[model samples]
Target chain A: MSEAVEIPSGTLTVTRPIGVQFSWRKAIPWLLTGPLLLFMLAFYAVPVVAMLLRSVNDPTWTLAHFHALASDTVFFKVFSNTLYTAFTVTIGALLFGYPLALALVRTPRWAPVILIMILLPFWTSVLVRSYAWMVLMGRHGLINEALLALGTIERPFRILNTPLATQIAMIHILLPYMVLPIANALRQIDPSLPRASSGLGATPWGTFRQITLPLSMSGVAAGMLLVFVLALGFYITPAMLGGPREITLSMLIDLQVDQLNWAYAATLSAVLLATTLAIIGVFYRLPGVSNAFRMGAR
Target chain B: MRRFPSSKHFSRRTAMGLIGAGLAAPYVRPSYAQGAWPEQTSIPDILKGSGELRIATFGGTMQETQVKAYFEPFEKISGIKVRYFPGTSAPKVKAMVETGNVEWDVAQLSRGSIMNLQKQGEYFEKIDYSLIDDGVGKEFRFEYGIEMLVWAQVLAYRTDAFKGAVPKGWADFWDTAKFPGDRALLGTTGGGWPELEFALMAAGVPADKIYPIDIDKAFASYDKIKKSVVKWWDTGAIPIQLLTDREVSMTSVWNGRMAALQAAGVPADISWGQGLSKRDAWGIPKGAKNAANAMKFVAYSTMAIPQARVAWGIPYGSVNIKSNEFIPEARQAVLPSAPAIKSQLVNYDYDWWIENREAVIGRFNKWLLG
Candidate 1:
């Protein structure tokens, strides 16, 4: 209220107090974010910090869990496998999602319909969706049954409980996470830039390549980051859809926790958390990704 | 009828424990034929109490079966109120005891889990054998807990899979050329112990001498069918689902789950030969509020009539040796405890697993992914 003191008429330069204006501007954001910041600190940050501490502190202050991970071939295999799956799923999601997002933005008349189509599956529980994938991709599932009816194959194809199944289901589940951001960015683009480029006698493909694609790179970066980080921690999908050897770090953490090997489980969790942070760091280091994150925050 | 896959097993262990006083639960009529009510054994005076005895059960169908078998009747006959919670396991008990806020008077856990936790610290109250029924076998009794129910992990195959040949044992399950279809086995995905016993038997190791398991020989056996095995199932439902889908023509499944599937006309039959019997036990957490009532209820639940009631409602076998007489022979034939089937099953050594599980799992995971 003090900062809102009105200036005298026709004297626009008559001075509000500079200190009050600066203090209010600085304090508003903090005041607005206070509760959420406290909640995240209490529920998320503290537990995560405690969990990271458990990696070395539990039972005794020891580095055996990390030491074991150094030579653990299964750990290495699973870690690499996790990264491979995340990368594949991100690329897959981008391939499917970017086109859908483009279609969503380009077709204004059908925007709501396309949005609902994307949002419907997004709103469904991941478990239900994963199970739906199981029913679709199982040996005797709908796809195989249809394929058999069409005489496309002599025998039922194995699809479920494989890496292929894991990627497919993860992409399906994460498509919206990729699509919505890209669509938002695409919507934010001024329509005249492409129009002006085309007006200059530039070909449509040339205009799109030179004008539109570069503008949407931020959205693409944002979408890929979201999908990849989410994919890194996926548990139920791979467990339900991937093969026995498709063990991810999340599953390994779960396994160790069940065995009451809290220290090892904490170590695995810390590694996963660290890897996610590293990926985020890498994304930020990429050109335009930091801007994408800033635009995403808006 | 479904069991926990390994990832779910942890949450399943940290089960909710709540006490309800004088709460009336809906009566689920026993699915099996009923014997005389006011069960032949009388409730002792000490067993009749007006207070609540909270029990931690693995809810869903198991809870429903237990309610029909003992919880409802025990509440009615004894003046003691029976309050049932779901999803109890050894870890929950340990958590409760360590925190000094033991919520459950009693919990249902595996003998191995109870012993594993007991070895870590004093989490359970020592079993009072004098209050227990004589029908419970000597083998089922332990210092801290008593095994109350028995189920088996056995080979289950589609009746239509092999045309006329029956896959009688693990050897037949491993003989994919003869069986001629995909197979599923228990994997170490969900903190579930791998079925090393099955692998040993598949390698022609006698059921009697299967443990101290020859891990190398077992893996060698697993190698023969690794390519043919389509799924390494973690939960009880997966194998049944696989069989129903004909995705895998043969799989290792829990006997009770297979029974449910067969009842649903899935055409899957369990081969009890060389199966492994796993037990669920009742453990009273140390410093439980109603420890005395829990003891009395434990004793009451294992009596021949109550034990038979449980077997009648669900396909799980009763630990009470006399329970077989009360259950019809037809029902007994489907249970793991039946003499014909029991003779073939190798009793699982919980002690052996408790000692060697971590090392074995590390080796198993390395081998599996390799």
Candidate 2:
């Protein structure tokens, strides 16, 4: 109360420096993010840094561990195989997810139930879901038995432990990740835009093609990024549903850990992390991806 | 000012000193993980309050049997509270031994797993032979651990798949023309021994002379059936699933899984010929607070009475040879360690695996992808 003084004459007073405003502004974001930043630093960042350092520092400063990962043909194949699976799963997710997302937004009556159905598996453990997939895809499983009894085929179809089964199971697991985002983006689109286009004598297909599809591209990109990045680290589904040829980087990492080659395991993990980061970097560098996020912010 | 040598280090030193008196652990790291030994309460004083025993074991029907046959009795006799953690114990053993904060008093480790960890450092307490009887198999008794039981990696087939000819051995398993259907094989275990041994047997090497495996010939033999093999199962349960589902006509399955399948009325038949049989052991972690009680539990659990109970419940061959009289011969026919089957079954060379594992696994992993 005492500080509230009236200016006696035409004098002006500045109590704080200009930098204080900027500093206080900066502090708001930092304060908001402080817990997350500290958590990431301690749990994720520190362990990752240690793991990367260990790739070179294990057993008296040797690069042999990295060299082993880089030089081995098996590691290379598994690395490439991981990328292939991720790509396949992403495409498959997008193909199924795009229309499901469209239907989810369009169906006024069943949206809640559909959303719950899509999100249901999240509550179930991934291992349990993978096992369920195994039962459904196995030779004596429902599909094969039904087909055989119908006399559609002479022998049981080969589905279990195949690449196709891996892809199918992965798409089932990741469909919600793709669908929810696209549906949210689609819902955010102005309702009048498509109506306005149709009112201007544009055909239904034309209106959708011109107005709705372009607006949903951002959602598509988001869903793709989410599914593809998640798929790269997948192991249980692939291990359960795919053959030896389905060996990927994650499985290779597990094998190394079990082998008691902790140093080598760290090296493989670093390689996998770097590969994921590089993929994300390239994904960001692609045209329209950043634009999609900026557009979605509206 | 400094709280240097940890209590765990002190305990290890006490253990080492006691080794001459037949109280040392099976293995002790020359240097404590945290370094140095600090004076602490004597072992007895440490256990004065906590009579709790924590055992890490796998969950399934077998674990159920263990709870009824071993844990319940041990807790009853020793007046110790027992808690069970269900999972594979190797990785946990590794983590606890490295961090020096051991939670598990006892764990059931596979022969290959125990041997592999032993090579890295001394992790298990040395066995107190005075407490254990000589009835436990010599092959399974380790300096740090005692026999748990034995299981096999055996060739199993669907009876309906072949009407006339049955897959008798590894050679028949290799012949695609005679029994043409999808076949399943295991991918590399930590040691590539099973595949290498079987491949040698398939290539006409006698089971007795299969050791010192010619890696070249084994790979060549593996290459012959590579196209015919449809699934490379990663887990022991997968092959059993494969057989029961009829996904594959023939598969290499764990004897227990096969037994379970057969008992459940699946038309699955397991062949003992050229099969690989392995023993599992019960080991105490080095820094476990209740190591003495854990040892008592292990010794009692491996006795004929307990072993017989386990075999009767789960149908695995008991480690205690004396349990043989208790397990009926009819039931013994299905166990890998049965006297009738033991002569034909090949004992997996655990030492060779311990030394040659990394190199062999590297090659096998490459071949698997190829």
Candidate 3:
């Protein structure tokens, strides 16, 4: 039955009472996704599934590729190197980026300028940044020339092909990823909680320790995860800036694929994907990350 | 209204099935072949219309040289429009061939690529040798592909490195005490060919005595000089950059790249001595659209004059022996097939690569990690 009702928002309406009524027609808009889903299936899912399958079925079924990956010191060494690089880069970015992010939040007048400076590097091509690092790090590059001119270091030092160079370049490239998320999370604080804590005889350090730090954990965790994951899969920077000992998993995959060793390539890729998932799997189980996930799902 | 639950259950089942299908479709999907390719032997017949031919090539200056020598001439003669996709890789070709939805009408394939994909079976179309000119060598010709060009991985060094005496070959390149500067060399992980040959040669094995390569001695030689080596140049451009920048005074690089760098006044020079010369070929992927037109394109590109023109443009050698007659003698010096250069360069054994490259690269990567 229809009834005239005037209530919320100063509006009047005469409408049927709400009840359970479903129609297949309501879902018709969802059908529009058919082509896109098909496209993803055609271009994405198929190749990924096929590659995963190839890891096992390639050149006759055997876990030999996996065994090689497990037993071989090369694979193990690379795996550990990649993990180490990613972890180091993550920590480096957090230390550098967290302070920058705090400054960005505190000085509202300079926020845009600081943000532009941080994001300017982010917007530039990763390849360009890597090449820039090369110019700065080469044998007679600006750093060495400057050092020579300054009379600080007598010789042009070697830095470009070392793990240190890789770390520096990677941290530079990924700093913004860590900064933006943490800055956004910092911006979300009520500002009252800290004030109220300080008013109740709590010291600034104690207030930050109990309230602000715990609250920002989600962003920190997310930033670390993002930077770590990206660092693990890095190819161009490592290939361009780092030498043999710095070779990562993605580079290994590229090398294997170029050699037309498909099974080996697939295995490496599968392991990378599995490792990424495993890391995320462990991460999601953490209190801060699980909270972030639950919030994201909402 | 009363008949709803059963049909609703049926509808839900249908949706579940549809979602399952949408997800699973591409993985289990059979090849959906397109185009009506009637059998024909004559390449000219394939090109008699205003149809288009698609080619896959690695881009940058390589494609630029190819367009000048191959595409322009073929298009002008055949009245067919040429379309190209750059950075087409072997893995992409493998995916296309395996999926049976081939994209390119023809592809530029490296020796490793051809052997790798061909060994997998029916990945490439069998060539009709009749369409191509007879000038292409029998050794270079294949049932599935036609040799396109020859390039060598050669030794290069900064001209000022040795001052008075030049480093003669890989042996001198390895003798850091004699020449004395930071050096660069690629292990097998860097597409290990010429390096292996160089290693064997440095260990006192002659070029002729190189293959069925004594892996043990080569590695031992590698061990001797590994400490002196500053870096392993992974990409083709790195070696030249290293030499020009004086990061490494001596390094190994592709001959053509060194020529380009020298032309650009990089103050670097190459030695053709004991270079690892290899050939690259072009083939149509299985079930390609306008495949016949692709064959015609490959055929025209392999002709002596076209081959010579491409070689002259890029300084890589033409696969066709008769291309020498077409190329001027000044240009011949840079071409790997030039009598003087050819005498010095050792042809890379692709068959040996097929048999041993995997093990070599594996061991090489392990050695590098160690």
TM-score of model 2 vs. true structure: 0.86
lDDT of 1 at A44: 86
Output the worst ten-in-a-row residue range by lDDT, candidate 1 chain B. B16-25
Q: B126-210, model 2: which lDDT tens digit per residue?
A: 8787777679867778787876878788899999888957889989999988987888887753222447888889999999898
lDDT of 1 by residue, A42-159 (tens): 9989978987998999778989889988888999999999999999999999999998999998999999999999989877766557667878999889999999999999999899
**Poorly placed runs, candidate 3 (over 4 Å):** A1-20, A23-46, A57-65, A197-210, A290-298, B1-50, B187-194
The order of the candidates by TM-score, greatest first, is: 1, 2, 3
Best by TM-score: 1
The residue pairs that clash in candidate 1, if any, are: B6-B190
Off by over 4 Å in 1: A1-28, A287-298, B1-41
Clashing pairs in 2: B25-B125, B25-B126, B26-B125, B26-B126
* Interface RMSD for each predicted structure: 7.1, 13.8, 18.6
In the range B246-312, model 3's lDDT, one tens digit per residue, is: 8888888867666656665667788889888888789888899888788778887887777877765
Model number with the top DockQ: 1
Instruction: State the local distance difference test value for candidate 3.
Output: 0.75
Off by over 4 Å in 2: A1-33, A148-154, A285-298, B1-50, B189-194
Interface DockQ of candidate 3: 0.23
